[model samples]
Every structure is written in C-alpha cells, then in structure tokens.
Target: MNDIRLYLFQSGSQLCKVHDIKMNQGCGQDMEIPVPWFLLMHPKGNVVIDGGLAAEGLADPRGYWGDAIDAYRPRMRPEQGCVAQLATLGLSPRDIRYVALSHLHCDHSGAVGRFPDAVHLVQRREYEYAFAPDWFAAGAYARKDFDRAGLRWQFLDGEAGQPFDLYGDGALQAVFTPGHTLGHQSFLVTLRNSGTMILAGDAVYTLDHWNETALPGLLASAVDAVRSVQKLRALAERSGATLVPGHDPEAWRRFRLAPGYYD
Candidate 1:
C-alpha cells in the first residue's frame, strides 16, 4: 500500500471577469472560482503545492496585493491560509519538507514564505522571469510573496521527460507543462487506491481548455499553452488519471475537500 496522502484545501475564492477565464466568452459576466492548495503527506516527508491566498489579505486586500486586487478580487475566510490549514493537523510551515510550486503567480505564491524550512522547488526560467517580468507580466506576480529572506530554493529547468519525481518514488511528480505563464507546471500524484491524478495548475484553467473548447484568458504563449494542455490530457488518458483544472468552479466541487484526503 502507498503511504502518500493528498489533502485539498479551499484557501478562498477569486472574482474575475469571464473573459479572463474563457477566451471570447462571457465578456460581461463574472466568474468566482475557488483558490485551492494541496498538502501531501508521505512517509518520506510532507509537501505543499501553491498554498492559496495569504491570510494578510483578509485584513487588507488592497494593502497586501496592491493593484493586483483590482483584476482578481479575493474573498477568504480567516482559517483559510497555509498556517491555519496545517494547524488543523498539528502541523506548521516548519513541518513541510518541500514546497513544489507550479509557478510564482500572486495567488499561487502568497503562502510561500510561510514554509521557510522547506526546500522550495521552482522552475529556473520561472524564477528569473517572475523576478524581472516585463511590464505586461508584472501584475501577475507580487514579489513580496516570494522575494523574502532565507528561504531555500531548488530550481528545475524543463528538461527531457521532464517530470521531476519528488522522492524518486512515483508518488508526487512535478510535470513540466508551461504556457499560461512561462515555466508554469502541473503535478501528477499517484494514490494508493484512488489511482494517479494530474493537478493542472494554470496550464489548464478549466475543463474547456483541457477539451480545446476555449483558450485561457491569460497566456504567455498560446502555442506553448495549447501544447501543454494536449500533453496533460493525453497523459491523463493513457494513465487513467483524473486531470484537475486549476480554477473551475463546477469542476472543483467534485473533489473531496481538506479535513478529507486521497490516500
């Protein structure tokens, strides 16, 4: 039996324009989607994947996120951050052994600093780009979230057969699937009885993108993004793994939330 377990936390939610979620669709409509984070427990160590919005935002959204809040306004409960969620299990940031970030976008990277003791895994290009993003790309990243002091970082460049297995055990693998943002990635987790699953971060915003029905509203490279979706979808099909979209309201509900887990 596998000793790995996965916990899904609903950190909070975000309100954005439908145009920002689906291309050429729902222009005037509003879309509210869950902001989620994952915790993986294995006999080897514990890991956190993009632990949602910062708890500070609950007190001061504008002060914390600044103008970025205008585009993706957030709504969060008090107990919905990395620290609070981990606390439920008698854990803390120091308890995390690794933090495998999909990318360093604001919403995704907000809780990074909390796990100072863990080795934070980031893509090399993603690290450089998020640090010095172009004018158009700057808003998506908030440096305060990641540019803190004394956090250990291990950079992964997209290499051939690029899924970097976390423990050399097929349990948690960070798959190189860029596109929505340069160096963006997805994850493949192998559960004992639940089977393998793909957590498609921004690389696949919703099922529409996975189905080729729509292009993501935000794309660093449309070509790269399209190829990524195809790659992830095909992998899921071949391996009989469930492909979870990054921010799909309807789809997100299908999963078992935290306080619950997939083992």
Candidate 2:
C-alpha cells in the first residue's frame, strides 16, 4: 500500500505586486504568487510542512505586519487556518508526529502553537537566527510561538549538502539547502507507491524563478540562494522527484487535491 498522500491545506491566492528588489514597483501583471501549506501522510504518522500564518495574527493585521511591506495582501483569511484545514481531513493537531519547518519565517511558523506534541524538525542555525535576529538587515521570525512547554525538537547540523534521513528506510529525508535562511532546509519524501516528492520550501518560491535561476529579493545572500536552487534542481532531476515550492500556486493546480483540500 502506498500509504502516503500529500495534501495542500491553505491556498493563499494573492498577486505578487512586488519585484525582486523589495521595492514597491506597483503590481506587475506577471507577479502573482501562491502561498500554500502542505501535509504529508504515512502509515507511521502524519508530517506537516510549514504551519502557515496564525489566525490571531491575521485578525489583527497590524500585529503581523507591523511596519513590513503591505504592497501585497494575502487573499485568504488567517482565521481559516491550517489547523482547520487539517480538521477537514478528519485529522487533529495531535495526529501530526513531526512538523518540518523550511525556515522560521512568521508565515511558515505561525501554526506551531497548535501541535504541542509533534517533534519540531528544524536546522539548528535557523532556530538560532530566529531567536536573535538582525532586524535591521534580515527582519524577524516568530520565535516566541515556539516557547511552549514540553515541546520536543530535533536539530540537524553538519555539512551543507548532506541529507538527513527522517527514517532509516529512505522514505523521508531532509536536505540542507541554506540561502533563504542560514539553516533553511528542504524535504524529499518517497511514497510506498507514489514515487518521490521534494518539498522545496522557500528554496525556490516560484518555478519561474527556479527556471530562470533568479533569486528572490528577500534572501540573506543572493549568491548562496542561487547555489541552493542549483542543488534543488540537480536533486529533482537526478531523483525524478516532483518538486513542490513553498509558495507557488501552479504546483497546486498540477496536483490531485483531496476533498476540502486547496488546489
């Protein structure tokens, strides 16, 4: 049995009005981006990637954005959160055994509060950056949300290109592909029957960017970011894995969406 199934939970349909320079260059017709949350199921347990923005933060937009750029607004409501989406599949927060974070951006770590029991799998460097940030340069990540009591965690540390096996059997693996953040990582999942899928977090936000080899403006270092993208592209090609971007909507349209699941 190919007990693994991938689900797109939150479908954030918004036009990317900003450009690669982080300046308000007006809404270019070619700039719409899709922000998505993914859930992966295995016979052993369920694993969620990137928790999405919290409902509370969404309710008070000022709280989430502060003085950040508002050139683009999410078309989806934060209150219609990822947890609620998981509920639609008859799964609760407790069902998730592991929560794999691509990086600690507020949008990706917002729902961490919901899964108190799941062991958080993140890169050690990423966690450290989130805790003490250079707000003047790299901005901030929501580290306070992770201070919950008894929260279990697994940190990956080693050479940059090495891969971490989530299970000894090669069913799930985490590849360190830093650039978007110092310890940012991407996951490679092999289904019992569904083949391979690579969840390439913000390593490549859009396929267009990936295809063009263009780095996003928000990256800490453009040089490192491009190197990461090259690593991802090589991996996907060599392994024949379906690469899923962190915020690309076209990927949603190309996959089979479960009922009540966002496409």
Candidate 3:
C-alpha cells in the first residue's frame, strides 16, 4: 500500500484570454481552465496544496475579486470550497497539519484562511514578495486573498535548484522552479505503485507551453521562466514522473479528479 495518498480537486475554473496564459497564442480567444487544489494524505499528517478560491468569492466574485474579476473571471461553486471538498474524504481543515503553497497568487492562496491550524509552508522569498510594498509590480498577488491573520506560517528557505524534502523520507519534496513568479516552486511526490508525480504549479502552464518553452502573457522574467521549464523537463526525464500542469484544461482531462485519488 502507498504511504501517501494524493487527491486532485477542482475547486473552480478561471477564464482568461488564451494569450493571458500563453503569450501570442489564441490572442483574442478565451479559455477557461480548472482551478485545482490538492489534498495529500500522509502517515504523519494531512497536507493541503494550494487553497483554491475563497468560499465567499464563489458567491460574490466582484466583492472579493475586484478588478481582476473581469480579467481572470473565476467561476466557482459552493461545493468546490476546500471545506466542502474535504468533507467528501471524511476530513476537514482541522485535519490538515500542513498547507503547502506553491506561490501566493490569488488563485492559489485564496482559501488559506480555511486551514487555521495547519502550518502554512511557503518559500521565504515568495512570502516576502507577497507582502513587499511593491509586490504588485508584476501584478498578480492580491492582498485580499492572502495576508490573512493568525494562520501559522512556516517559511522554507532552500538554495536555488535544490529540492527541499518536507518529510525525512523522500516521499515528498519541494522543487525550486522559480519564474512565472519570483519564487515559484513545484512539488515532487513519490507514490508507491504510482511512482513519481511532479506538480508543476504555474511554472509550466500547459504541455504545449512546456513543449515550446512559451512564455506567459504576464511574466516577471522570460529567461527565468524558460529556465524553470528546462529544469522541470530535466527532472521529469530523470525521475520518469508525470507532470501535473497548473492551468491547462485539455491537460487536466487526463487525470482522475477527486473524490478519486492517486495512491
């Protein structure tokens, strides 16, 4: 039996012009991709990867999302909230011991407050960039979604290019794939029968993007972004891991969405 179980949940969908995600491709066309949040069941504790959209945002996008609401246009359902989805597995936020954030982007960290007791794990630089006075210089970090009070935050400071093993065992680790954002990171999870799976969190938006080394519409550093993809490709080749992309509707169809799981 596998020591860790992984569940991929569709928290919601974010619709944006295709060019917004991948530069120059489908310039005037719109595409909607599922917003995914993962639940990892570990022997030591349960972990939530990316909190998805806030529950309130589901009912009132304009109120919570503001101007970006018109840009990203997230389509959320009440049942997709972290709390409701966890219930399907006979769990709750309190059951989560750690909430791992790939980055503090609104789509990724909106529901972080739901797991008040879980220790929130984020790259130190990513956390700092989220709160920096000029954090919005690149324009995606939303203060309303993050910057919540009382949640236990644990900063992980790992050397660039080095993967941080969250558990002593090699079952789970954080791969530093900076780009897309200053401190964007991906995760590598090792399962028993399933082998290895790489969760490429916005570092590589889609398989097409990965294949062509395409840049996103909004990017901090194109050079760094391409480097991140190259690193991920090499890692995937090295480990023979299945790379779970961040926001690719077509790519997402290949997976079994929760309440199904990969163990």
TM-score for all predictions?
Answer: 0.97, 0.86, 0.94
RMSD of 2: 3.1
TM-score of 2: 0.86
Off by over 4 Å in 2: 14-16, 20-30, 69-72, 136-140, 147-149, 158-160, 260-263
Specify the poorest-scoring 10-residue window by lDDT in model 2: 20-29
Superposition TM-score, candidate 1 onto the true structure? 0.97
Report the lDDT tens digits of candidate 3 across residue range 29-121: 989988888988998888899978877776677777677777798888888888898998899768989889999888898558787678888
Model 2, 1-263: lDDT tens digits are 25567776664554445463232343454456666677877777778888766666666655664544254455667545778878877888899988888888766775676885788888998887777767643334644566567778898883555788875667778888877788888888876556788888888876755785355656776677788888888988898888887766666578665453321
Cα RMSD (Å) per model? Answer: 1.1, 3.1, 1.7
- The order of the candidates by lDDT, greatest first, is 1, 3, 2
Off by over 4 Å in 3: 133-139
Query: How close to the true structure is residue 17 of candidate 1, measured as C-alpha lDDT?
Result: 90
